[model samples]
Target: MLTKQDVHVLRTLLQEYAHAASLPVNQEKQRLWIKLNHLHMERPMVLIDQIPWNEMDVDGSLRCLVADTYWRQVEDNLRCTLYKFRHMPADMVLNPYVCLPRPIHNSGWGIEPVSSRHIELEMGSTAPSREFVNQIQSLDDVERIKIPQLTLDEKREAQIIQEADEIFSGIIDYRLTGLCMHLGIWDSIAMWMGVENCYFALMDEPEMIHALLEKMTEGLIDMIGQMNRQKLFDIHSHVCHCSQTFLEDMPKENDLPLSGNAWAFGLAQLFTSVSPAITDEFEVQYMKRVFPYFGAIYYGCCDRLDDRMHVIEKLPKIRKLSCSPWSEREHFAQVMPRYCVMSNKPNPAFLASGKLDEQLIRDDIRRTIDAAKAHNRNLELILKDISTVNHNPSCLWRWQEIAMEEVQR
Candidate 1:
């Protein structure tokens, strides 16, 4: 239980953050981003790394149901503060709201859950990777996989919103909205069958692989239909993980936002090792089945899409493409400028080196900026997939300093 004093402290901190977010400077910067996203004009924008909360020194004393609510608000405020102080081009908004009917109960593809164990190499690591035991062994197992029916618990959802409102009514606004589904086809299949097994299945059992992909695609389409039927699609106009670009077409107050008004993301990180042809056949073709359901698409993650640019070009709604660290920067500068927003993902490994190198950081940012300028591309730098900062928060602060310096130049 949170003491009255605890609530007072939290409410005070939240109000201060909300006030900062409401400033005109932040609002204009966000509008600039929206314009750049819609291809109305070209400009550079940056989203500082989405740092993991466990990486920071946050107080963990709050407990129970209140603790859950308290921590969520606290973390957002803290990160927003960090971004402002570092001069990173991240947007700040008045309220921190989340959509409901998250669709957690339904595991669309009916595959046996894989067993996994987390192995942490060091203390304060960003997040641990799991060692998985693959559950699907043969083609027959694919038949057993069935798509589960989705059901929304309205009463429980209302109770959650009520409790949150009571706690944060005057401090900050609480909105019950909808969110887009981030459904990855290749990643799910690789999770069921081992990565190696998935590769062999492509050649040894091409027919079987196609059948499994078809089934998974069907399940995802059905899940999307369910979400639409339940009125769970909400407009995400703020800075979100769904896309690096901002939404140009947001629904009006009286209108219900559909998936077409929001950004949808699709990735095939596991398909990195596969040939472009195989990736196009197995991943891109299946993804196309679901991509049209959204207003716009954000494609790629950690994977390099250099060879498969042609395949990606086929997606009519793709508005942003991830230019990962592994991608050829020069090549992408030439290809991506004419197409979509170049969502450049800088390598986060520098943070784990235990020492901050200002020169190295500057040079890295300079190279990316130079390449983007030469091609006239709309760029957004996103620093993600960080595992550690070696307990030095200053490294991220320095990185933002260097990145903004380069952007201004």
Candidate 2:
């Protein structure tokens, strides 16, 4: 039950969101994103995500006024949306209607790792120097990672809509949509045991690695199949890993599950040192089982995949290829097919410094823009994995401005 204050807070934000959505710039961004996604690009696009919202403390932007924990989250979201629009809205679409996540509970894959040491940083965010606890040592131990089952609570889901409607009866409407499904098998393996152990096992116990991967692969496929069978693949994903995803290809009006309508994000970020053939054998082969089921796939993350394109390209339905800061941008721009959207993930480390280097950030964006321009590739700049902005919110605002200037140039 939302109090009058909660309803007032929500309705106020709803009016602002509705007004922002009515703007022509958002529609133009939608056009640019659709063109880039379809590989019919006139110019480059920019998107910033994985932002450090904790640090964006300007005039109570992040401070929630609501009382209830759940409603406070709703208030926080509305506040953040309006804040981003005012601050550094890159190429993201400000959708008019409100969206509520369906109450879907997942009986997760049962494996937990331990975090022992914490490192407080002077510049970056505090992180855990996790105790690389090995949960999988034997072949039978892999059986512990179960196939995740999802249960959608319809009553709760309806209650949320009813509550939202009673609050925003004439303002903005709401929809129950799911989020993007990212399938990273090796990432899961790294989480369960340890990233270092994952590499060591590949060399020392290759058979064990294969067995573990095989089970995990089967488990993920089972999860996807269950979602499809349950009609739970309906996602209204605006972006997948900071890359714009709204496109004509991913039909909005579809009958079959969104497995064949939306995108599936995949990556093996720690596969940086592994050879193409080895990655192909261990990672790609297994992940491809989960890939073919999706309408489209956006592959790679912070990994330098320029050299590994031979193996990387083997995965079917790959529309977006991540060209991270480590990736040889020129090589990827020249090598990747013109049809594939080159999602150039710019490094956010510059902002983590004591002071922002405008020229350095400018040069980075310039280099990527040049690479894409030279090869005539479909390009989109994505700044992600930002842990901290050195307590300065202007770091990101300036970054988006520079990125937008570069792309629009």
Candidate 3:
């Protein structure tokens, strides 16, 4: 259903993206990051804030694409890169191509869908609150949970792929990419049983909690097995949790790798307030079931892992750990040196105040740099979870400038 205008818009963006990809600097930065991830000598890297786009002053013309899902996706990717080019300091590789198969729908899960009541936030509130309608009220509900089955529609997939190929035949390469998986066990269960219930279950119904975790883990393992059998897993590089880490042992093109050769990300932001012992029992133990399937692990998110270093330290495949704003800077600076890349997440709240506080931002960056240097930890400064820029796009650009200057200093 693409009109002449739609095609024109797409071509313009693709050409611009292609030109950006062809830059030699982008390739050089990519090589540098690869070296850094491998523990080779390099300067501390910085990924300009992973802005929350929902809170930004997005351009109106691009917003018009929302009416068409396919075009909207293309627009979003192009818009993201365009913004990065204009402001962010992260490495920008020029190849604008991405391979994704037509969506494969899944059904037949043993557990019934959990319901929740979404509550709107009051004016000025940052995030909306939700009340979980507990679906697993007792032990019997645990037994009802079953493994899920996945099915693919080959004919539909072929059409979708063909359409994508036709749309960008000469503009950009659009090929099929493999399946990517993220295992969020505790968070998934908390949604069904409620976060409070999960905490209480650890004390009152320990056995039941164990049973549920076992079932969920088994279900996830089965899903991975199914994906592998279908040759759905792809060789894709992601940076969110792993911080420029790549899979060294990826399978050859058209071949598939077992979970042990693939990259996996796991985190439990929901368990941040729990004791390490409780976290170990409920979160880490269950995660172990799936972690063995991946070649490398990227752990942690917004949670402060300063106190639970001992627990995560045992994860053999961990290559990067998110040292969020709430994390103890000195503790991570010490422990992460011996473990993995410190994915330092500076507070984005400094920008959320509607004006750029250059001095405060520089001071914060200096403290992190000093701490990481003290212990000789490989650090990747990642500014993320940005809720707002108060409609000032220049705030991000200035922040990136300040970050690069501070890091170079």
Off by over 4 Å in 3: 48-50, 64-68, 92-96, 108-127, 240-242, 247-258, 337-339
What does candidate 3's lDDT look like per residue over 1-409, in tens digits? 6666776777777777777767787777777777667766377777764565655545553344533565667667676766677567465444446545446767755554355776543444345466676777678988888888866677767766766766677877765655556777776777788888877888889888888889888998998888777756545544435255543334445445456556768888877878989878888887877877776777888888988888977666777888998888988888763658888898988987669878999999999988988988877788777766776767887888888888777
- Pick the winner on lDDT between candidates 2 and 3: 2
TM-score of each: 0.87, 0.95, 0.89
lDDT order of candidates, top first: 2, 3, 1
lDDT of each: 0.68, 0.81, 0.72
Off by over 4 Å in 1: 1-10, 40-42, 58-65, 68-104, 112-117, 240-244
| Model 1 lDDT, residue 5, Cα | 60
lDDT of 1 at 277: 89
Better of 1 and 2 by lDDT: 2
Ranking by TM-score: 2, 3, 1
Tens digits of per-residue lDDT, candidate 1, 165-247, equal: 65576766655656666767777777777677787788898888888888888988887788778767656444445244445
User: What local lDDT score does residue 48 receive in model 1, on the 0 to 100 scale?
Assistant: 64
Name the candidate, 1 or 3, with the larger lDDT value: 3
